[model samples]
Target: MADDPRPAARRRRPLRAATIGTYALLTALALVYVFPFVVSLANSFKTDEDAANNPVSLIPQSFTTAAYQQLFQTDLPLWLGNTVVVTVLVTAGRVLFDSMAGYALSRLPFRGRNAVYAGLVAVMAVPGVVLLIPKFLVIKEFGMYDTYAGMVIPMLADAAGVFIMRNFFESVSPSIEEAAKIDGAGVFRRFWSVVLPMSRSALITLFILSFQASWNELPQMIISTQSPSLFTLTKGTAQLASGALSAGSQFPVKLAAATLMTIPVAVLFFVFQRRIMNTTAGGTKE
Candidate 1:
């Protein structure tokens, strides 16, 4: 008997429709998400009047480098340097400490481990804003206020990052570490060579997250430091928008600063996006 093609065609029709609709929806969402950045980049090259006049437009009517020139003349360079220093230290510290804590929580069976895990989960639920005042008091009491130490130290470890690493470590095979131990490898050696290297995806995820968090952090930076020399990109940019560097609304200058601020994080995410996706899809298995 000859097979009929009608049923096959019928099955494909809805599938094709669904695929097209899905792509259309996703494309629309992508445009919506990308529109603001495009507009901001365009405005950064425009004069204040042009930006104000065509705020929603993605093209500059009159191009000018004045905003960037004016921005460079201010404390932005110093702010960038400070942001870089704090971000690198904070990211590095979080990656190291969070991974260690996570490994312990996942692999090291100890007294009150459950309690510690529960505490971390609870901490994650608590709003960071609620801790601002308490953090300030502690920093002040420690005499670390207005110092880079104050800025970098408070953000060194995050409960969420620890939780992420712990979950990733738990998913990995226990036998890997067990074998390393049987080979006479010490705890630290096993963790560094066997466990850590296998958890590359998780580590990169933590790095991207920690870098972005520290880079964009505003409240902690504000609470920790009052010195202009210690201003991060977020704080400095806020000041610029609020008329610290110039009188009235310097729209172009503010937009230019904001545009520049988004670049690093964007680049980081794109560079590691495949790694993130792969880990998310096929998480490490025991």
Candidate 2:
């Protein structure tokens, strides 16, 4: 039997080797990916001296929550307020406007549709960094500078989100839309009640993506406002990098600020993560 099992043995040898190599590579990559966040968490609890002394330790010799305490007591609350305002306005506006525009581009019979889409693509191609100064200048010209409106409006209409939505709308069967029309449903009614409800998965995916993008956005904040009270978490965190918050080294406060900034997006990711995964899986299946 051993001599007769040569083909099976050869197959098993290659499979075993491939499996072992995959696990080894994945384990090494996981550690590499996780090490920085681990260090940040550990170092956040360390005193400046301890952080300096043991830069590489994951375990704190003495744990401290002072950084968090100080964070709550300082500009963190204000930054949190600003971030909430900007993110909510940006996400809501993007979802409503982007979807509407995308739907029109995909389904509605209208003139200049292709031109509009081409324009959006062109807008998307314009690198964001290049827009920093120009966006500021426009905000100033529009008298929106240093205002929440300035911060929220420029980012509300992202072309990428519109493109994502446009593709999704196009992917849906046209037969259902024709049926709705036959039932005497108006354009708005069909879209509002029928199509949108069917697009729950795509909408959720867009929501999660827009929330993450707007929440983590840093440069927009820097360019839009100068007042301390208007500063978002990203702006405040950038300030924390200057070492002005602490008498000497304030890594804890900075880390705590970053942690606080991370929480809302973290919560959002957790809540809607399955929808995101499902959307990706569905795309792969197609």
Candidate 3:
């Protein structure tokens, strides 16, 4: 018996068409997403006149590092340092505090646990942007203005972080915690050694989130500090964008600052990216 070419051809036709359509759609989106970064990276090395004149050009009309040089001459370094400090502290604090509070809410049979969890849900509903003025008021009232403690302590714990941790803990099996509890382990000991270890995936997810949030945070920085020396990367970048200190004619400097500020986050996202993605999204196939 001879193979039927017609049926085989018919079977492959739909598959081939679907594959082609998927590739086409993906290619269009890739171009849309990557084109801007490509343009920004190219323009960063361009001279001010070149950047302005050839805004859309992938190639620089005149290549120069003067913009980068001038950024170093300004308060760029200080801003970068401030941003790093705050991001590190906030990420660490959120991971520890959120996890502890969450474990208590999820595992510990404490008084008013239900009410406390409900209160956190309510707090999370209140938008962060709307709290800027209110946060400033409290910070000033506590006389924590213009200090490192002020900038960090107020944001040390977030309601959303707690809620996320609580949800993640709930998703975990309670038997493991119960086993540890029956094994003569105290609450902190069981949580620190057993429960938290089991929650590595969730913790990594929270750490990445906290780092990104504190790093990109602009409004919080604005409300927290008034001194020029206390400015974070985002704060300083905005000031530069609005023609602060430097020659307004030059844009390479601003673009360079933007590009450099993006490096740490880009590196973070690249490293441990799979773990971060899987943890936040529940699960993914390789």
How many clashing pairs in candidate 1?
0
Can you write out model 2's per-residue Cα lDDT over 1-286, one digit (the tens) per residue? Answer: 3568889999999999999999999999999997877788887887767777887898978899877887788788888889999999999999988888888898888998999999999989999999899999999999998999899999998999899888887777767777779989988887887777777788888899899998999999989999999999898889988765757677767776777777788788888877862443222211
Query: How far is 221's C-alpha from truth in model 1 (Å)?
Result: 0.8
Q: Candidate 1 vs. truth: CA RMSD? A: 1.7
* TM-score of each model, paired residue for residue: 0.96, 0.90, 0.90
Spell out the clash pairs found in candidate 1. Answer: none
Worst 10-residue lDDT window for candidate 1 reads 277-286
* Segments in model 1 whose C-alpha atoms lie over 4 Å from true places: 280-286
Candidate 1 lDDT, tens digit per residue, 66-185?
999999998998999999999999999999999999999998889999999999999999999999999999999999999998999999999999999999888887786778799899
Instruction: Give me the runs in candidate 2 sitting further than 4 Å from their true place.
Output: 1-6, 277-286
**Candidate 2 overall lDDT versus native:** 0.84
